[model samples]
Target chain A: MKAIAVEPGAGDPVVVEKPVPEPAAGEALVRTLRVGVDGTDHEVIRGAHGELPAGSDRLVLGHEAVGVVEDPNGTDLERGEVVAPTVRRPPNGTNEYFERGEPDMAPEGAYLERGIVGAHGFMAEYFTSPAETLVPVPPELAELGFLVEPISITEKALEHAQAARSTVHWEPESAIVLGNGSLGLVTLAMFEEVLDIERTYCLGKRDRPDPSIDLIDDLGGTYIDSRETSVPEIPDAHEPMDLVYEATGYAKHPFDTVEALAPNGVGALVGVPDDWSFEIDGGRLHRELVLHNKALVGTVNSNRGHFEAAVDTLASIPGWVTDDLVTGVYGLDEFERAFERNESVIKTAVEFDTR
Target chain B: MKAIAVEPGAGDPVVVEKPVPEPAAGEALVRTLRVGVDGTDHEVIRGAHGELPAGSDRLVLGHEAVGVVEDPNGTDLERGEVVAPTVRRPPNGTNEYFERGEPDMAPEGAYLERGIVGAHGFMAEYFTSPAETLVPVPPELAELGFLVEPISITEKALEHAQAARSTVHWEPESAIVLGNGSLGLVTLAMFEEVLDIERTYCLGKRDRPDPSIDLIDDLGGTYIDSRETSVPEIPDAHEPMDLVYEATGYAKHPFDTVEALAPNGVGALVGVPDDWSFEIDGGRLHRELVLHNKALVGTVNSNRGHFEAAVDTLASIPGWVTDDLVTGVYGLDEFERAFERNESVIKTAVEFDTR
Candidate 1:
């Protein structure tokens, strides 16, 4: 089996031949179909984060993947069925979170994420996953299944955002996505397909007429170049946003978005900003949160339920949006080119030639 | 009519004579019975916050009052009925928050709070309020009705906290209240009475065996001296708190409380800290909030429904706790004595001779 592997602390990823994994009890051997290359993969390659499996120098690199169950030993899954494997697994020892099927909420350092952390991932010819952690995707979505993982992130965020605003009748009329990355565009698409938001906006730093901006416009949403416009000024230019979906890694957007929220509004933060210090009006921020009943929630990875919902979400999104999003697909041998990001690329996946 | 008044920059409150307020259409004239004096009153007297009504040189100094409806002109309220008047009133102009019956969620500068901001409060011998804003209280809770206003503050915080954690099956087993003042004590009391928390702890900066500590014990909760134990050390001392009710005006407790939360825990912030700058590990804090699924919500004033809930909460409190909480009651002539703070005092109120 050929797999993309990165040596811990090494600068780049390498293609290596490894023995195919064998499924143990309650595990299914999956043949990789497609693995999406995103920012996390780059981080792993750069040795900024992630871990190698115990006693191993090389770590496989992909968390967002689609695969076929090649062998379903001691499990309910059918062979050859398409599935998306969850990225995170319970720690070596059992804790309440994992026992309750909420590994996503596992405490820091308590869980291991395949490729992103201590375990092996699916950027290989074959991988083995626990039966329960594999979410079955419809055959129609097999080619587009790599998106399920990223879409699940938004599903979890929206789920919690709705939960936070449950105390009052929160019929939000407008929403803004704070980044025009693939995640942001997908979030905007989800709002259009699912939520009852009458007006939507996407904020990005790119100059006018980019793919994301065009996609947002095509989705009947407005685009604001954040470089040209400040975030706090948006609500006054338009209306106070009822919900702000922050996917930009710039930490300031979350704070600035809070200032623009309508009374009782919520901000769903999905980006993990780099460590940067900025002066914040803590008193004013606290006052707004307290007096206006605003809430901001930060969400990361998704759980099985979110993954299932993501499958449904992907199926419901306008075909054109999904088609426009997967702008590039490269053969497994062209993994380096696949990892290269560009202005026109929404998502680029490495397709496997597994047999 | 006599009223407790404070000149804008004056450091003391004095009793002054005022005209009896007449009930207008959709208004009720309430003869004050008792008004609870909390920290806000002191802040108002110090001219640190609060505003004088329209052209008046002084601001009436009470927001938590229990009174009898002396006149119910053009309203459903009946004369002689016991009521607890809510402090906040709709701003001169209308906004969705007030029109939608959620003045507590009103944006800054949108609502005027009686006694605290632009409107006169229930500190006078008689005060007028819109009939709709006066929450009806049963005769049994008349003497203790002033406690409703403060209790309502906790109700709103818990309301938002509960709403924020609604995404999961959040049956919290342990809780810690971050202050031992009247609000903190009331918060501990509410958790004991309302939530199914197995263990409760109240943190205060006081010697052991004090009234607040003894009162917490009487309520079947533990009291920790925060001077001896830091916030982050709490989980290791006992367990990571599932819920933290932070009522201390200390600016750092909320952030520290976030560090102490268990996965999926919610921190309800009810205190408004003074302007103070402190370095926070923003990256670590962001990671905790994102990876642990923790939520922190800031809640200030409460609306009529919260007041109604507060009434029920006060009535359900163990009689001894309520009796001991209001440590003193001073006549209008001795108003200065009620404003004095000491270690032994829990809560003090100004009683009016309405009869």
Candidate 2:
């Protein structure tokens, strides 16, 4: 098997040939399919994320991938069936909050190796995982199956906003979303369908050399070039946002909308802002926030409930995710190109040449 | 009529003669039985807090008070009835969230001429207020009804915690409360009766400074002095806290036991730390607090349900607040003495006769 491998301490991961893994007693061997590149992967690769353990060499660094079980795994999985397991190993799979029921607490996240992290990842020809780790995907989910990781994030965040439980029939109070990237767009899509939000403000790098406005607009989202617009000065109707989603991963901090929250509004943090340590005025948060009864919540991943909601949502998405957002797709050998596209382009996919 | 009034941003208030208030339609003329002074009064005098319109002075500073309806001038009240309202006198008597069950957003709070806050407060001989502002205190509740305001705060904090809704039953969990002031001991009392926490650590002012220890002992709480023992360390079997109430008002500061929270723990905050600015590594809070599904909550004058619960608890208090916590009584004319005793007292009652 060919896998993407990174040397310990730093440096670009190399895609190299490795032996395909066999299923252990409680493990499931998965044939790689679609692998999604996120901020976690880039950090792990650059050694900024403290990914590899003491003895590990080149590490595997992919967690968001959809694959099929190749081993007749022991618990809850069948060979040759599509699944999207959150963890790379048994106990520590996923992040700390990704429990099965509370999938948000899923531990043992996969980001160490395609052929490296601690175990091999799906950025390779094949990867091995535990039996219970898989989340089965249907043929209807083929194009967007790899997105379960990010989509589940949106689902989990909406759980905090209760975006899905809106009762004004179809109209939610207006929403302003900062960061028009994949997560932002997906979040906007949620409000678009699940709630009756009259308008949405997607604030992101609209002036990027290669912009992603079409994706936002395609999802019926209105884009705001944060570079161009004064976010905080967007008038009271927009100033005091009904909801604000911070999704810019480069420490996309919530500077504008936190205090700007409508008296009893809600702010959901979905992006994992990397390498930033700042002070939050708990008093001001209490005074201005709890005083007005505003809330700031950090919601990580979703539970099985998120996956189920995403599945139902994905079923109704315009073009159902096939029309756009899946910019490019390549085979497992092109792992580097996949990451390169996520950087140079935005939202790329790694398709497995399963046949 | 007499009122204790604080000039704008001054340190203490002085009693001043004022005309008896004429009740407007939908209003009531209530004769206060007693008024309670609190840290909120401190905020008002020092100008740190007040629900005043811009550039206003001659503000009264107390809000926690009890009285009897002298005349049901226009709406919903009868003559000679004891009552305590949840402190509101909204301009138009409504605000965004309060009409929707949020009292914290009330526009004009009860802090005016009655000698306390926004609207006339009850630190005076007679306080004019609205009929609906009254919360009926079953006559049996009179002797201790003045304590309702602080109890309302405790009620709110617990209600915020119950939103998690997991630990409704008395789980075998311990709590370490920071500070042994009124809020602290009140919280201890709350845990003993409402939360039923197994072990409670009330870290007080290096020594059992006030009657908080007695209150805690009365409520069966363990007292700790951070100065005496190394709070950072604990024997493993000594259960980590399930809930921590920070009543000392330290803003943006982390508690020593913050890192000691078990998975799925919560830290409820009522303290208002003075410093307005500070910083923290968001990742650490996520990894340390949130990722493990730990919650840090900011609660204030509680939601209505907590208010109801708190009243019940206060009513169930063994003595009618006379024997222990309530240390002295003074007239509104002795404003300075009342303020002095409020600083050095557990709780004090304001006698209206001598004013």
Candidate 3:
């Protein structure tokens, strides 16, 4: 089997050969179809984030995976069924979170994410996973099934953001996505298509002739150049947002999101920032949060329910938009192009086999 | 009528004589019986917070009042009925928040809090308010009805906190109250009597012989001396908390509360901090919030629903607990004693008349 592997504390990823493993009882052998490359993947490759499997010199590098079951191995799934595998798994046997079917809520030591943490990922030609971790995908949407993982991240984040405002009669009419990345564009689409939010805004540092910004415009969202209008200044520059969806890992966005919120507004923070310390008006931020009934909910990863929701979101998004969003799809021999960062690139994937 | 008034940027409050107010149409004239003194009152007295009404030279100082309606002024409220007036009112005309009975969610310029912001309060011998703003109280609970205002603050905070966890199967077993002030003690009592949490803890800086510490002990809550175990260290020294109720206005506690949370834990912030800038590891704090599914909700003031819930909370609390919590009750001549902070003081109030 050919696999994409990254050596921790080393440089970029490399293609390597490995033996195919047989599925154990209650496990399904999945033939990889497409594996998505995201910011976390780049971080893992650069040794900035993620961990290699224990006692292993290298780790397989893909968490956003979609495949067809090559062998059901006595599980309920059909052999040809398309599926996407969830990332987090119980580290030292089962814990309470996995027991509740919410591995996303597991604490640090209790769980590890495949491809991004302590276990090998699905970037290989073939991988075996516990049957319960596999979420079935409609065969008609299998070509775009890899998108389920990224969409699920937004699904969980928005779920919590809505939960924070549930006590009040909150109908958020306006929202702003704090980044113009691939995930941010997808989230903007979800906001417009799924949530039906009236006003949508996307913030990016790119000037004119940017594809992501164009995607935002195609989705009928206003794009605010980050250089011209910062997050906190958005209320004065445009309008106070009813919801702030923060996907930018910039350390200052969270504080600015608080200032950008309208009364009873909620901010959903999904970006994981690096260790950085800076000075901010702690008093004003704290005061705004308390007095205005504002809330900030931090979220990461996703569970099976979110994954299921993501499939529906992906189906609802226009095909032209997804075509533009996924700018690159490389084969196993050309995986390097999938990880490239260019001004025009939005999302990229490595295909091991066609669905 | 006699009232406690404070001049903006002045030294302290002073007793002054003013004409008794007349209730306008759709208004109620009330005779103040008891008004509780809190941190906001002291802040107003020291000119550290709050604004005077338009064209007024001094601002009256008290928002937590229990009174009997002297005149209903053609409204539905009956004369001689015990009532408590909600703090916030429309600054100009009715805004969305006020119209929806959620003045607590109104933005800064949209509403003003009586005795706390740009409006006159109920510390006077007599006061007049819009009939709609007063919540009728049972006469039997009127002796401790003044406690409703403080209890309402916690009521709203906990409501939002629970809402943040509504999406998950969150059954918080252990909790911590971040201050031992009157509001914190009342909140601890509510946790034991109302919420029925199994393990409760209260954090304070008080040394031995402190009445607040004794009160916490009586409520079956563990008291953590802040000087010994800081907020961030609580998880390691004691245990990671499922719920953190913050009443201390220290600038750094919000960040610490994030670190002290257990997996899927939530913190409710009610204290308003002074303007202060400091450095902290923003990355770690942001990461903790995302990975652990923890949440922090900031809340202030209260509405009619919260006040009604607070009345129930006050009634459910043990009478001896309330008796010990209110350590001092000063007459009009000894009003200054009610604002004094000492080792033995838990709660103090100014009594203009008896029930």
Candidate 1, pairs of clashing residues: none
lDDT tens per residue, model 2, B147-226: 77778887766655545424222143778777766667666776776667778777765454546677767778877755
- Candidate closest to the true structure, highest lDDT: 3
Candidate 3 CAPRI classification by DockQ:
medium
**What TM-score does each model's chain B reach against the true chain B?**
0.98, 0.85, 0.98
Tens-place lDDT per residue, model 3, A217-314, is 89999999989998999999999999999898888788888899998899999998988888888887888888788888999899999999998898
Q: Rate the local accuracy (lDDT) of all candidates.
A: 0.85, 0.61, 0.91
Instruction: Summarize candidate 1's per-residue lDDT along B80-180 as a digit string, tens digits.
Output: 99999888887776788788888887777888999999988788899999998999999888888899999999988898999898777788899999989
Give candidate 2's total backbone clashes: 56
Consecutive 10-residue window with the lowest summed lDDT within model 3 chain A: A248-257
The lowest-lDDT stretch of 10 consecutive residues in candidate 2 chain A is A163-172
Docking class of 2: acceptable
DockQ of each: 0.50, 0.27, 0.75
Error of 3 at B146 (Å): 0.2
Best by the TM-score measure:
3
**Clash count, candidate 3:** 0
Clashing pairs in 3: none
